[model samples]
Target chain A: MGKIALKRTSLYASGASPVNLLQARFYNEDCLVYDLEDSVPVQEKDAARLLVYNLVKYQRPVGKYVIIRVNGIYSEYIDEDLEAAVRACPDAIRIPKVEHAYEVQKIAKRISEIEKAAGIEEGSIELWCNIESYLGVLNAREIAESDPRVVALALGAEDFTASMKAARTKASLEIFYARNAILMACRAAGVEAIDAVFSDINDVEGLKEDVKLTRNLGFDGKTVVHPRQVDVVNAAFTPSKKEINYALRVLAAVEEGKRQHKGAVTLGGDMIDKPMELRAQTTLAQARAAGINV
Target chain B: MALNIKQTAVAGTMESSDVMVTVKPAEGQGLVIHLQSNVLTTFGDQIRATVQEVFSDFGIRDAEVFLVDKGAIDCVIRARVQAAICRASGEGFNWKGEDK
Candidate 1:
């Protein structure tokens, strides 16, 4: 669970579409999720799996994290999905509708077996668990800590609201609790928390506001359905110039304090402690990941 | 290898960056490929060579392969052909064994 690079936006491309798959890497999103779950038609499952396998194995995307979103844990397609996805060797495999820690463990076990059989380095492939239901949200912490392979827990609000039998709205008052619960769980478990997608692709303003809310709520990133939303999300997640400058000052003050053999670290007459230093480091890390000079 | 073409099967779409491949049993005829691509003048030979290589990899000597290419790359072409042949043969793909 060490620090990883910033993943501000994860874009979804239909697994069955060859055109989309080929063009996914050129986009600005930090992560590209080739979806094989809800996006592919039932009859086209085999076709989509083969296409994704070939795309990941032969024409793998460079300079971006690649993940394959498989079917639900209970679905019959999960086995075949894991088999092909593991062999394809993407950065991670995202499992949808995960409700329990055992589901994560079960899939991790299966992935381990596949990796062993395929001669792939064991524990190389990671997993991202999607929390789509009330149970999943309640058990988010356990799911996040279920296995070492579980790196992030993403909130799937569309399905969560459906599961709660509630209406979905633009303000997103309904999913507020679930969002916070997931964020806290990810923080407690020392894993990344991803927010749900903003479904209204046409409303750029609304999308920007939503990204603002996601960043304010301490989410690591947001799931984006379209390529156009990538820059919006990445911009919202990146640390601002003012914040980066303050972080640089904080780190410099800490270094100066160390050199002076001082007992306390201070910048601008305010006390700087461990948490503040860590936050400053994280801000600088995010800025660096965003390709800033700092 | 050792794929038996039991029936006609098709894979892929006619969209851009994709190729629609239809494989049919041509017992006596040896590997007949009818390819129509938008980039036929420039990439026709390369595309045909890719198909031929896939056929050789699958150890198929007799089949009528019909492909309508929309400027698909080599990987897409290879995937569509393998999918079509696997569907035609009514068998699961031995991905590890058929490492290309």
Candidate 2:
């Protein structure tokens, strides 16, 4: 309530297929989403669920966002997915390829009811919408603003590429429109826009560029696929020291303005009012969330 | 045998024959850890590795550690492990600065 930090966004990372060994590694990532959806295969679903559940149960990391992306809506095991996720009570459940507001409403409603029945804290498990298809891209705004519990939006690159009949390249040039669309939708709806994962694990430089693009485009965070990707993603998403120094100056000016009974102030000769104050506060929030002291 | 992780409050007593020290958090912004030691020295790198490995799963950054031996059984190990977690979690805030 002190200050709202919009930059404190959550990220989801996709684990490799063979989960057990690497899962612990991926779950340890700095991103908020430890995606279980695309990473876990149909066969290892149960084991993955158990592993996630145990980890969450015994050790709840303080202030870290850890949501599980359950299997897709069409997966035969959505019910099981819900059961496992509901039992675990992660910060949220990410639904892939959400085509309409109704999809979000339905999942939100179901999770709400389950939380009621299970006696899990109401609103403990929120919803995350993934815009993966043409329909989903069209409905992105509605999906982002649909449910109060739906706090984040994600781009599903592979499915979206296939749906658009675009080339799947290392640079991800084809999905530019969709990416911007999703980001706009998220910003409009007052939620976080998460960039899609870089599927090609070998393209570290390409991944870095993609991360930069998304960050520049106002993405809150990007989903990662490998442990190697985690460090870079974490680094890129974090507020730079220069930004933090600016934020500190902004906060200082705001404080001084408050003492002087002025509604606004200036920092480094730049106006520091509501919007600027909000942005600086958000920057600080993000830095703090990422363990950056500034 | 079920692996055991245990610790005593800074004010409490811990006498270890086997001790494993796991700093779940290394420096800044510390966090939770599960430490186990048998005959203290026996814990060696494996105990250190296990604790480090477990801490990674939780993404813990900064933490402190200590272990004691009484030639504990597996169950004792589990109890001590819980205690270690509790202490690290700041449950023993009152015992901060007391001798082990």
Candidate 3:
């Protein structure tokens, strides 16, 4: 058995009306994320911030993680959003539309300043970057690897498609390279890679397809706009029984081979080498974190 | 009757069955509500939680509430509770109230 850290899959739901409070309650039970940028209109942004700050004062749910998705680093609202995040002390701050590692450093520096000003410990906050543009995709690896505070990198499909002037069709071939690149970067950096939201709330089948593709691409999880999408994303990201069984088998075989003085072993008629063993270990760890028995 | 519809005060929409209200305190009085609905089990708690959130401006104890609902979204719950409170308190409500 290996130690695993499970980052809760939170639905970034933010709109006026105790959206922050609703998120607070939900996150108390499950992972819930609040977005103060795109989800809120300009006029309501400050109000949203205020509500979020106030809500964070209350006791949060046990084992539920809270993340505030702030505006883009380049946006004028980023400063205010940062101030709010510092005041609220959410588990993580998601900086949307990040293009470069410098942006992460910039936000981290600002967070440090705020922590200093607020008498909070420096580097206590975590950062999550949203790779929503061509430049962001190109720099995804560097960005994820730049700051230790970067817990994950998210791929924003809608914004990415818009930025690339490409259509989001059933196949989504246009964004294939970007998705793979982000996943690779996350893996290289040993952080989570989150997939973008499915825009068509009504198109359940389409959303399912997208989830399947991204999960197959090694995305840790998907961001969901609607509550109905949560169950599907969770199911897609969770390891199947077959995978869990294989992981269990692999571990058992490795243990046995080690006992027999064999350097390698075979499972499912394939040789289980060091890489396969490492993968099996990781799979088992992930399954356990997701509450699936291997 | 299985349910009762009481209008504390009306501002935006009351013509159709979709009632709307904004709960506010009057100069010398407060809002009280007594509602019973066949909406569903524990609907009272849901409505009460929402009313408290939407009208946090008013004193919770000073406000008395009663609601009969036929399954409503959070929006409708807030609207109806506010309308009832406004009607009971005799205070004018701004239909475009700030979101919770």
Query: Over the true interface residues, superposed, what is the Cα RMSD of model 3?
Result: 11.3
lDDT of 1: 0.91
Candidate 2 lDDT by residue in tens digits, B1-100: 1121233333112433222333233445454444444545675454445545544433444566554444433322332333344444443211111111
What's the DockQ for every one of the candidates? 0.58, 0.02, 0.05
Instruction: Assess candidate 1 and give its TM-score to the true structure.
Output: 0.93
lDDT tens digits, residue span A35-151, model 3: 788877776565456445545534434565677888777787788778767766778888889998888998899998877777767877788899999999999999999998998
TM-score of chain A of 2: 0.80
What TM-score, computed on C-alpha atoms, does each candidate reach?
Answer: 0.93, 0.63, 0.72
Top-TM-score structure, candidate number: 1
Per-residue lDDT for A181-228 in model 2, tens only?
998999899988888888777888988898888887878877765666
Name the runs in model 2 displaced over 4 angstroms.
A1-28, A32-36, A58-63, A247-281, B1-100
Error of 3 at B50 (Å): 17
Summarize candidate 1's per-residue lDDT along A1-294 as a digit string, tens digits.
Answer: 233476899999998899999888898999999999999998888888888998898888777888999988888888888889999999999999999999999999999998888888899999999999999999999999999999899999999999999999999999999999999999999989999999999999999999999998889999999989999999999999999999999999999999999999888899999989999998898899889999
Query: In DockQ terms, which candidate is top?
Result: 1
> Alpha carbon lDDT of residue A198, candidate 1?
100
Native contact fraction per model: 0.59, 0.00, 0.00
Count clashing pairs, candidate 3.
17
TM-score, prediction 3:
0.72
Instruction: Give lDDT: candidate 1, residue A236.
Output: 93
Q: Rank the candidates by TM-score, best first.
A: 1, 3, 2
Per residue, candidate 3 scores C-alpha lDDT tens digits across B29-84 of 34454544565466666766676675565443444444545444455455445445
